[model samples]
Target: MSENRQIAQEIIEAVGGKDNIVSAAHCATRLRMMVKDKEKIDLQKVENIDKVKGAFFNSGQFQIILGTGTVNRIYDEVRQLGVTGTTKAEHAKEAAKSGNAFQRAVRSFGDVFVPIIPVLVATGLFMGLRGLVMQEKILASFGLTPDHISENFILFTQVLTDTAFIFLPALIAWSTFRVFGGTSVIGLVLGLMLVSPALPNAWAVAGGDAQPIMFLGFIPVLGYQGSVLPAFIAGVIGAKLEQKIRKRVPETLDLILTPFLTLLVMIILALFVIGPVFHTVEELILAGTVAVLELPFGLSGLFIGFVHQIIVITGVHHIFNLLEIQLLEKFGSNPFNAIITCAIAAQGGAALAVGLKTKSKKLKALALPSSLSAFLGITEPAIFGVNLRYVKPFIMGLIGGAAGGFAASIFGLKATGMAITVIPGTLLYLNGQILLYLFVNLIAIGVAFALTWTFGYTENLKQQIENDSKAA
Candidate 1:
């Protein structure tokens, strides 16, 4: 009777009823279905479903773009229809056959990181606010100096802004453990131990202001503040090790011994080998990322800006959080955020252009909200729900993003945080570069809009949507 249920019912029928489905999973914006036979699917009907944006078969799955909140409801309804065929374990086993090694790895990375995006988004917003509040000129305007501001007040704000990054390893560790079927608490505790007060802060060690706590007089050990790869590797090893140990440990003592042995073994590995090896690899990555950002003629920004959304689509963009953290640690700024913001804005602009151009009420309805979602720093709706469906708009957005990225690099524009973008991103530039931030976003939007308006979205597509709506 309800709209989402009705839509889900239609989708279930179009996918050849429950019998054809092998497994189904929903991401933030898409309903990923593994059907026994692709020939059973009604591709056009799926595309024409009222709120559906697009549909395609890829990686041995029939994936339909249902868009954010909408996907969850439809997913629930389909599950309620008893269409399921595989358990989580079975699905994982089957999924291993769906893609090449690289694709599988990217999907696994997404599985590990996507759930924590909200926390990262919140952290970026807090970082932006801190940048604004700590601006000397702004503070002076309010009859306050850096010294005049209460140290306690500053510390409170710092806690709000810095807690996430300071303990990022814990969050990642917990999530990774959950994904990999390990006990989350042990993972969390192990992460905390990596950044314990007993060790020097990673940033301080990098700055040469603090000495590493030497291990065995040959190896150096320090806290892993603002580190990703180490925590990620540690979590994987911890999870696998725990599962193996669980099988060997006695059932009676399992409760006591499993956790103890898991922690003991994991901690030793994390501190001694995994932590040092991954930390070194992370440093090389950081150095390479910085070198690319500093490349001449803004080539780095142009290329990254154009491809950033594609990276996000694959879900490996979380890896950049490490790069951003390192950049902020070393230089106190994040140019990557500024460049990525332009990419996001371009997608928003493209969707908005489609909203304005489309004659069909259904197209207009879908396009507008998708555009707004993109501007709010969530682009799944715009990218999956609108732009990619139309095709040309997505390409136009990339061009716009490249232009904006070029301008940002030319001016050396930077942000104080990561994750947040577009309107909320304004807070990031509030320290002294708000105008430049606005200018870059405006340029991205303008270029994307102009291009999309000129060449994206054919009249045939508009008429087709109108016809589909009428039939429904």
Candidate 2:
């Protein structure tokens, strides 16, 4: 590892040393660099660096992925270079100017949310499995769901699900603060305010019913619980305001008045303007989801399955929790259950394919259990270790997932309960379509497995790895 670091250092030195580096940031796995000259970067030497997991240059950024902790360590080293580059605001401006729908949408989402995928997945797995146990009556014998709807299992599951979303704004606020170079503590305060139970009623009611409170003379302080947009937008505005304020305000007064005044104004604007605007946007998205799910099961399934991969990639899949819980609350059945199960299973299938394909004994060993974990409806292992390690596997998982989703839709399979495990997930479709759902699921998994094997297990894979080894 030390030797690899030295090699990495040498490569960095070759790439215009500290002068060429414009700015640096890191996600969960990758060290993202904005450089003065991409041409001066030595890709081969960097690849040779020990502990370097992967390298890619895209989106006008040079990325060096070092897996877990190494990314942070490397980020510190890059920061020491004291280079400058375009800020996130500038990046957003460029994206806006491009005006390409898909690219713009993807870039907007990735910028705000992609960095937190690992945390979301970890939290999601806990909630998913907790749902499975309750739905399956696995703990019923032990009084788990003894009261049916009011069971401990249900209560516990709700807490888990709620925690992920309830704190979402805080999470987003923290990330946005970092991106905008603001005091994270201020972001925390703003996030807390949004989620705070002590605030005045911020929800609107119908007809003669109660409505949200208006702040000051005109602005409405809309409730933004379990959301990201409100805090994120506020953080952006606050960051810009903070820079201006910090420059003008004396250092002694800055500590006292700057944050206080910033928070006061940002909160007012967020409540009246930003929060309500995004709330309406979110409602439209929910309406769109409803409209799509009302389509023929086949089409609905296709849409859900296709979006599942996109959602997973964005790490906003948990945003679906509110929808699912609402389905159970109002209709007693979820329309999007099949999409979730199929996506997870697809990930496992891809892992199995990679395991069979890889020449590395260690990777093969890891893939075996990882695939099984995914098959059992736990996909983290497979996703991080196998599918993501090799790009083909992730693509295969998506293909397989889409197929499974299509089949589920065509069959109109509805799960009777919420569960993460494959067998337990079957209960959700118990409205006499059990056989159809099972058949479709088998087809989805089989197709995914076959495709992954064919494409990932080919001699080409071995040759590619061998070539990589030789180059190393």
- Best-performing candidate as measured by lDDT: 1
The TM-score, computed over Cα atoms with residue i paired to residue i, of candidate 1 is 0.88
For residues 305-420, could you state the per-residue lDDT of candidate 1 as single tens digits?
Answer: 89998887665576676677778655768899889999999999999999998887877888898888889988877887678866889999999899899888888988877668
Structure candidate 1, residue pairs in collision: none
Model 2 scores a C-alpha lDDT of 0.64
Error of 2 at 160 (Å): 5.8
Candidate 1 shows a clash count of 0
- Tell me each candidate's RMSD, in Å, in order: 3.1, 7.2
Where in model 2 is the C-alpha error above 4 Å?
1-54, 59-61, 64-140, 143-145, 148-171, 195-209, 214-221, 303-348, 354-397, 407-445, 455-472
TM-score, each model? Answer: 0.88, 0.62
